[model samples]
Target: MEHPIPSRILVFGGTGYIGKYLVQASVSMAHPTLVYARPSSPLTPPANLKLRDRFRSIGVTIIEGTLEEHEKLVSTMKVVDVVISALPYPKVLDQLKIIDAIVVAGNIKRFVPSDFGCEEDRISALPPFEAVLEKKRKVRRAVEEAGIPFTYISGNCCGAYFVNLLLHPHEKSRDDVVVYGTGEAKAVFNHEEDVAQSTIRAAVDPRARNRLVVCRPLKNAISQLDLLSLWEKKTGRSFEKRFLPDEELVRLSNTLPDPENIPVSILHAIFVRGGTVGFELGKDDIEASEFYPDLKFATVDDILEVFLRPGAPEPYRGNFK
Candidate 1:
């Protein structure tokens, strides 16, 4: 059980929302960090370009290539001790290719596939949510079959983003907060950065080998109504509470005209059915925070502050119907 923390780390989606933080945390922790990025381009947005430059400033080596380059992937893996894939949702299955490369390279001490949401294997969600998790499940099976030592991170919801999605945190002008189901089901909501850091901790910690690290910060677990009340107290305004019961959500999932309205359906699973209800720390799972107690996790109130900031990104206009 005693193993040295990994000194070298490689991140596949390093420029992404969560991966960027992983790269930062790795570098700050004094690990030699590398990030996989596409070849530079004039068409690349300035923000992305700046992020690449920033990673370089903090000594993160950026490897330029695509997943199709199996030889290149193997070559890159040969230099690192850990591989953390933070690939976007649609691209989750592409990690199968990464698994193949890891098997070929054969030196990876820990492989953390991108299951940064709920514990998909344990939770039975609707088709839209299940379909997304099936891709990740494939990657997980591939890694295990390949004899790779792995750690699965089920960090539940990323508080800021999902809270925005669930509660419409950025919609200050809105006179009401929609309450999904009875607004009484509690779920874990770890800050995305905390999720990233805890994942990195698990990747290198020998104790975490072949384990499932659940990020259910006790303080971060609360109901939709708990969040609404917090927001109301923070703003000193009681927004109208509109209730969207479970039956209505299920009906909407079945009847919505646009088959592409899967996002709405996913919301039904998380808010109505309680996507993270299956795993509770001390009752059914191990807590990632127990491994790194010194790390301070942001509270729901802290997350709300960020979303409520002036000129915060516009409220998501997607399928919140």
Candidate 2:
């Protein structure tokens, strides 16, 4: 008997927060990974430069080009079986270029767009957050219209990112935590690595093709108050709970400008409106845990434990600014 060769993967925005994990997961699973990133110059941030060097050392082929380069995107897409885009929210519409290139290449087995967040199609959020979801929905429509084989990932809340923001584990001197709404709305918080691993698995999975792969493990589903209590137990410290009601969240969402209101609106959606856990998985949907039983994913408790460590570094906040 012979083993099947791993699919070749091309990752856009491969040096980003979640993108790095996707690239790593692809390489770990023995996929010949390639990264299409902006060409680095002296103006490039040192951290980004180091990430590129690290990827090079790990044998990831780096293709230097922007999304505007249609010829380059087409040529690059021609060589890979899968294209995973981890571009941030601001660049959501930019995926249209990738879609055009995929159509021209006509060989990609799967095209996973940058949707490692909530199930946009199902949830009704505040205007700011809804705008973001609308952009993602637009991309989804484009992909479907182009007849591209694809997978849409709704990985829910990134665990470390949210835990750090909500709990402020790094701020040891801080004595209080913000409890959104009544702190009882259940939401899914998945580790970034787990999100990436499951995404990589689904990119090659026939069952996941053209399906919405949701990363909602049972253990990871907990309320804001539950997360607060867990962190309290882990640190053996009781912090003051500052409750921010839904009305105030909405007010802030309306008052705050641009990106600032974006995160606040998201908080209202997930914590107050129960955006993540609100919907039922339809016939087109598949829960990641059940879909990939063999893949072990870290829970909220596991993520909290990391933050409890003395020198645990903070997770990248990305666009949650």
Candidate 3:
């Protein structure tokens, strides 16, 4: 919890889009870092990847392994002071196995589980998002039961990943900002760098242990209209916003029988519910402005440049849906 972590920091799922950034950030520091991957994950090792690479470069102790192997997880974790898990949401609940192994292996002062989205810690309840929250809760409980020092982190937005997943302009209607229900509901978002920095803070801060940290970029809140305004300003184009009425959206969604297609109504409920204000950044994330005074984050305009503006960026080059 001092100037930096003790050393030998390990990252699970270190080859993901964000995971690569985390490893890049950590390996640049004057401490040892290790990465755990299955050697077959979708993220291929970049060209000329190497342990000597630093922030945005190739640098990390790339250990090929699987989280399913309890013995290997324990063995690798045994040598590290902290663990930053960047695995997918799908593998979150299974992290119980990893936590169990860490507790058994011991000497682990901290663990940063892979929570890189809306602040479940601050959001009083989970609705459509319950399935995602359920996994996070299970992993937290596993860590608590194991008596391991932990930092439960909720970030603004996972930067590129979320934008890529959620925002997709209709191909035919290029000027419309498509959203669920009224676009008035707000949810705060932070860049991947911001999340990574807060994670590093949580990893080393002994005082931050056993805490639920919600973080975001330092700024005033904005609504979907405001977002579209920013897009208009950035792209110099006229755009119309299409709002989906709540009831009709629900009826349309209910027609789909599968849970996979349960409907946008459910997801809309989670977003509009009282608890999830787009402005949410736990006290610490808001306070991070002081520690890293120059920290910069992408804004609505920046997102629009690649997402909406005509000829701003290639169709295939954007990060969002």
Candidate 4:
């Protein structure tokens, strides 16, 4: 942590589930954090945000604007040193416009793009994946071209992946975990809280000064089927799941080079083939989950039990930005 403390952060998408946590955490770190909550539109409530008493307690400055909402962005960036973006993964390019606005204003010392799902940098023109990676690459290039100090926080799947889709006890589908092959491909999967901590680490430590900084926790990895199995153990239910045959999955995967409607097709693809990248690293200075600090990870069992289980008590409730 070279810098004593970088102050004044502008967090794009601060009303998101993870964004609210980052906002509260940033405020706790005593950084003057401003949230880019859209000004014209009414913000929708982000379920896991508003409930935190600390969230309410934090003296967070809310800036209502988008990247195109230049006037507002400039005004807010005038005082901030770092900008941590938590916008949707697909919108990484649009977020670049925000980065441009920040640099144009002559302030932002560092920028954290909303790239917390798999190492997009490592992905290639594999069927269905080419286009998404292109967008991510474009945004990264924009930062490099602009000479903006940046950190591409790489994480596997979000807590939502386990808690919402595949292994939750209360899945919309009661099917045995749908998997690719035997589902033994391990990859980095960081919890939202850990990712936020990595963001903070990137924010605080000048040493993490790479054009792309990664903060993965120690042994914070799992496989597609094992993850489901972990959930099965926790929920004590054998899932009625089906495994997509490799040939069929690969054939289906062929349609993904440039998905027709990206978001929709991507969903279809994941459900069809089931996906994995098989990467895990030593705690890369991005590990900070006091909620279960002792445990290396939430495990499919631990996270869903808390975040995904129906009627589980949530921490904050900021609306989606």
Best by TM-score: 2
Runs in model 2 deviating more than 4 A are: 1-4
Write the candidate numbers in order of decreasing lDDT: 2, 1, 3, 4
Give one digit per residue, the lDDT tens place, for model 2 in 154-236.
Answer: 99998888988898888879999999999999999999898998999999888789999999998889999988888888889
Against the reference, the lDDT scores of all candidates come to 0.80, 0.91, 0.62, 0.60
Q: What's model 1's overall lDDT?
A: 0.80
Please, what are the lDDT tens digits per residue for candidate 4 over residues 61-125? 66556567777777777878888888765566787678768777887788877766545665443
User: What TM-score would each prediction reach against the true structure?
Assistant: 0.90, 0.97, 0.79, 0.77
Candidate number of the best lDDT: 2
Model 4 TM-score?
0.77
What overall lDDT, based on C-alpha atoms, would model 4 receive against the true structure?
0.60
User: What TM-score, to 2 decimals, does candidate 3 have?
Assistant: 0.79
- For model 3, the stretches where C-alpha displacement exceeds 4 angstroms are 1-6, 41-57, 124-128, 162-173, 218-220, 248-271, 278-299, 302-321
Error of 3 at 91 (Å): 1.1
Where's the lowest-lDDT run of ten residues in candidate 3?
Answer: 312-321
lDDT of 2: 0.91
Give candidate 1's error at residue 18 in angstroms.
1.5
lDDT of model 1, residue 266: 67
Error of 2 at 112 (Å): 0.4
